[model samples]
Target: MILEQAILNIKPEESIVFEKAFAEAQKIISSMPGFVNLDLLKCIEETDKYLLLVKWESIEDHTIGFRQSEKYNEWKQLLHHFYDPFPVVEHYETVISI
Candidate 1:
């Protein structure tokens, strides 16, 4: 499995609006190929920050497959504007498990 992580820094006072938009965006991502699941976490100390953990079957599933699909355009339209300075996305593979 591939783990995609993004730390989203939303503008202050726009958290609720971003959450609603993100819900819609999540629906789009869920329908894509190789998509496993997603977890949205909010920082208690930094209310404007959020962490998105997305699981995919492979990196290509996200980079080449989903990003090239029309659904991604819609997803971008829905949630991209909410970011203050755009989040940096990174991927990881499980090295150890217990």
Candidate 2:
């Protein structure tokens, strides 16, 4: 499995609205091919910050499959505006797990 991670920093006090938008956006991503699961964690120290983790079967399943799909536009429209500087997304494969 590939792990997709991103640190989302919302614009100031827009977190409440962002969360609501994300709630709608999540449905877009969850329906994509090779999607396993996802989690959105709010930061304790920085209320405007959030951690987004998604599991995919392969990198292309996200980078290519999801990003290239039409649904991505809807997803972008829903959540991308909430970001300030925009988040950097990275993918990783497991090394070892207990």
lDDT top scorer: 2
Q: How well is each residue in 51-83 modelled by candidate 1, as lDDT tens digits?
A: 999999999999988999999999999988889
lDDT of each: 0.95, 0.96
With a 3 Å backbone cut-off (N, CA, C), the pairs that clash in candidate 1 are: none
Worst 10 residues of 2 by lDDT: 77-86
TM-score of each: 0.97, 0.98
Residues 10-81, candidate 2, lDDT per residue (tens digit)? Answer: 999999999999999999999999999999999999999999999999999999999999999999999998
- In candidate 2, which residue pairs get closer than 3 Å at backbone N, Cα or C atoms, i.e. clash? none
**Which residue runs of candidate 1 sit more than 4 Å off their true CA positions?**
none
Best by TM-score: 2
Candidate 1 global TM-score: 0.97
